[model samples]
Target chain A: MRGPDAHGRFGPFGGRYVPETLMNALIDLEQAFRQCIDDQSFQEDLHTLLEEYAGRPTSLHEASRLSDALGGARIWLKREDLLHTGAHKINNALGQGLLARRMGKRAIIAETGAGQHGVASATVAALLGLTCHVYMGEEDMRRQQLNVFRMQLLGAHVVPVTSGTRTLKDAGNEALRQWVAQVEHTAYMLGSAVGPHPYPMIVRAFQRIIGKETRQQFLARCNTLPDVLVACVGGGSNAIGFFDAFVDDASVQLIGVEAAGSGLDTDAHAATVSKGTPGVFQGSLSLVLQDRHGQVLPAHSISAGLDYPGIGPEHAYLHHINRAQYVAVTDDEAMHAVEVLARHEGIIAALETAHAVAYVLKCAPRMPRDAHIVLCVSGRGDKDVSTMMAYKEAHA
Target chain B: MNALHTTFAALRKQGTVACIPFVTVGDPDLEVTRALLPALAAAGAHVIELGVPYSDPLADGPVIQRATARALAHGTTIGDVLQLAQDTRIDGLDVPLVLFSYINPIMQYGINALIADAARSGISGLIVPDLPYEEAQDVRATARDHGIALIPLVAPTSHARIASIVAHADGFVYCVSSLGVTGERASFASEGFALIETVASLTDVPVCVGFGISAPEHVAQFSRCCDGIIVGSALVRTIEQHSEALLDRSRRVQATRDVAHFLRTLFSQSSGGAQ
Candidate 1:
């Protein structure tokens, strides 16, 4: 059946590998989450927030021009970019924010790389009137100053993490450290399907709205499920959410795209599923880009959102069981897809989302003309315009 | 009994509190780590916890975190640390060696190989902060097979679960002095002592309190309730302060002596100062 049994294991991955100080808190969180799942008021509150606040049921649009350009399968876009926060991150943020309020936590803390999750968490904290602290790597803060400022404008204190690579991995370490120190009154609003037990399960549950809506919309429009689903994998939150509803469907091929910065032969990349090995990272056993000494290596990517060394333990499980296929696309390919999408569909996609689009551009042409493929556009590209321009200037 | 248990037993018999000092191996370099071990032993450390530098040390605060970074920057690995331990013992450092590490490095080294090597190197115990009670059964069993004590850490948050957490615990129970990562703190949590007391009540093994313990006052306070006191971040910070002197070939001996002096003064206030 669906994994992560009582001990939070999927085969051999996913467990609470945190310090003893957070064990009781995790157990209580798990209990509270289980109760919230069955509580009618909690469900209604979450649904109402998702619908009235975050804007649910994001449209599934037919990308006929892009489809014809690829010249094989019809391409459909799950428009999570249309969400209020300009990303699918709002769904989990609102859900977890409600949970934190229910748990009577006075404050919320989170870590971010590309800063979409930080902004979304700050938005929720502002909506719920909770004090929020967002830990961001110094480098990410430099790269995503706009999102960082957006979080500050939403009334969240942004703490810069300067330890170990000064990126998402270090940001996560710093956040967890803060959470441990402040577990009494704080709820760590983990933004992805990584970390310890119950988090992967919790985030997946909150984000499953993507797959749920896509299923109903696809059936209503096409009268059949799409042949394949594609989404980029950082910590695999959006991909896991997009794949949840179709996991049991034997014919629905699940494809997760990982960022291969430069190339896999080089040291710079975030292709955890493709190049990583099983190891404990950020409180869970997962596919991690680490040295032979088991020290986590820094991951590089054009997309700050996808520059992470660890994959979600659930994604690692899915890969292990052969239920899903993972592929890597270089920064150049993703950049090319960004241009192609903007030209063909008049849509600007985040660099992270372009990884999925890059994969679709490659595989859609190989499939039958009648076959349909759905790609998750996880975020808008407003946050990446400056980065793109800089890259262009450097390359030119 | 193993070296850890025997050491604790002897300290219990003598009515003296066990003083454990932690140092990150190869912080400046392995030569300094080798020189510091005997100094710590001479400074009245009953057992020394040698920290293996890891890229991601989540359970550590800024002090030890920086220490690990420095150690890793010098290219320190688990193998180097274990080799250092063996080398120091060959030079006649009699204190039991307890390895403090994250779980990933141990996994990379291979669990069976690690236990075997640790046993061969005369390592008495292991304290993997990330390997909590829930997922430690297999590792506990493996360490047991090799006569290595896989020390378990219990925190103030581990209420009602303390018994099961330390049921078959071997060397000692590491009681975290507060609800945070390792660093010196002005004061510990209100429930910290009660948690230690609760663990002492449940386990036959000696209970040692660590985390946020730096000052002699913290050592004296925890010594009243627990069998031993472990100072990590504070000690690591001391080594860091003297890292330049330690790295200097001519000044290394003085640096080691200074670190030992710091540990000595901290533990000198332990258990009514009978020592």
Candidate 2:
């Protein structure tokens, strides 16, 4: 009930629906993950790397100015943006990179949307001296050119995917294809808590450091648990990591904010939980934005990371069972949150993270003045400076 | 016996390997696909695999992906392809038809309803590349109830899994020729032959080699061991090459003939006489 069952189903939302060729590999991966997690040396190495290399125990800072500006709940920010790759994605990337190395794979392949994961994977590959290939959508490469260059600069070959709306979904398909072609020597370093079995569980486990540290830090600093926990849900990596530790606590409210590109009323939103149906997508059964005939619909968002048609299956399961609540925030609202965070807290939060902040901005003022809310600022928004400037010019 | 079982049984009795040709329905539109089915049968296809164009086809390479894009561009769906099957059956087509699809479209169509309709539409078998043996229980059970063969695929990596995967395999065991998506490979390693031998050792069902089988030599090579050979991307590539001709009213017949001619040459090289 906390994680997936033995067969990897979070109820009916997650299962291994992949080609026969990948089945044995998945089995091997699951076994390796189980072994590695239990091994003390593996955990020690991971802990050392997190502390020394990638910077662990990311600070949970209470934003007094931002909280006072909101005038209701006192807001805390989980500072995932301060990690080595400027995002929480490094947690899973490093974990998977180590797993791949332990599996005797010399090369790693990954799919990226906004390119934060690509950069994280590339950085890990560079540090570990493994060959890396990052499959990115052509459109994403264009929009996130800075991160694209960062991946390339890290010695990762960036392959542009031009199929299927020229976005993250197509990048995923291309990565799977290439992984199939060279699965013998390569390991797929999946970016998020999506994909087939063991992946959601694995990513959540790797990223649980976030929630673990946050819980300890918040309780130590405030002498009590936060009343509310919020994180943006793009494949639900950071959000899942942040929520897993508190899933059993009935007193804490967990909210996942989805990207509403224009609005949920329009056809152009990436709000999967807001407007999606159960379908198999990218190796897992989850809530997907697809046509009536099951063709995946193109998702749109100012933030490339959130522009995905499918949500992570665990999040779908959580939503289905009413363990968590999911809400949507529009691009404009997210952009406004970006500006507010920058002005009030000197934090340039990623657009994906801004969705969470935007939702808190709307709801915090209505909560009790003593209520506490922890928001996951999942990534830095330096990559979005250009997009932000362009948006401002257009609006002006 | 079902059409798939009957076709494979007859092929084994005749001491010849079956030739299975795959095409994406609604590529260059549905009418050409309709014409290609019977044409492929005439060109000695023992069974035909109809690929449903999906939005995301992870098991396919660029060639079939392009075919899918073309097919989906025209708004092709599982319903439309099944309708095509019904129409072709009405046109007196006798070759066994296997619907090769990714699992999403079928899940969207509602599994029970799709299987019943597929049975009614003369679809002989189902091949969902994404549905491995473990997750295929409900789909397999439904297809079994409807008397449709849910063909299973085995790869070199399938190793000890081959037996359990083929435990309830109906129709033929689809043996992936290599460890990759569907496309043409310059040469195949002996791993394919070993995998096929292992699969044959496990199941009584006929084993067919597919994935990366492009030329006649590949078919001839695989025909020596397997009960059949499946040609997907190669034949779909042929359709792609003739897409301009297929879309033209005046050149459509010639293009269809050319495709049949290509299949004939490919089949002609196969020493197996069953097809």
* Highest-DockQ candidate: 2
Per-residue lDDT, model 1, residue A36, is 93
TM-score of 2: 0.99
Alpha-carbon deviation at B113 in model 2, angstroms: 0.8
RMSD values, in order shown: 1.1, 1.0
**Where does candidate 1 stray beyond 4 Å?**
B272-275
Which CAPRI tier for candidate 2?
Answer: high
lDDT (tens digit, per residue) of candidate 2 on A6-82: 99999878999999899988999999999999999999989999999999879999899998988999999999999
lDDT of 1 by residue, B122-209 (tens): 9999999999888988789889999999999888878887888899688999988888888999887668899888898888899998
Instruction: Report lDDT (Cα) of residue A15, candidate 1.
Output: 94
- For residues A1-396, what per-residue lDDT tens digits would candidate 1 score against the true structure? 897899998889999899888988899999999999899999999999988988888999999999999899999999999999899999999989989999999899999999999999999999999999999999999999999999999999999999987889999999999999989899999999999998999999999999999999999999999999999999999999999999999899999999999989999999999999999999999999999999999999999999999999999999999999999999999999999999999999999999999999999999999999999999999999999999889988
Interface RMSD of each: 0.7, 0.7
What are the TM-scores, per candidate, against the unseen true structure? Answer: 0.99, 0.99
lDDT minimum window of 10 residues, candidate 1 chain A: A48-57
Chain A TM value for model 2: 0.99
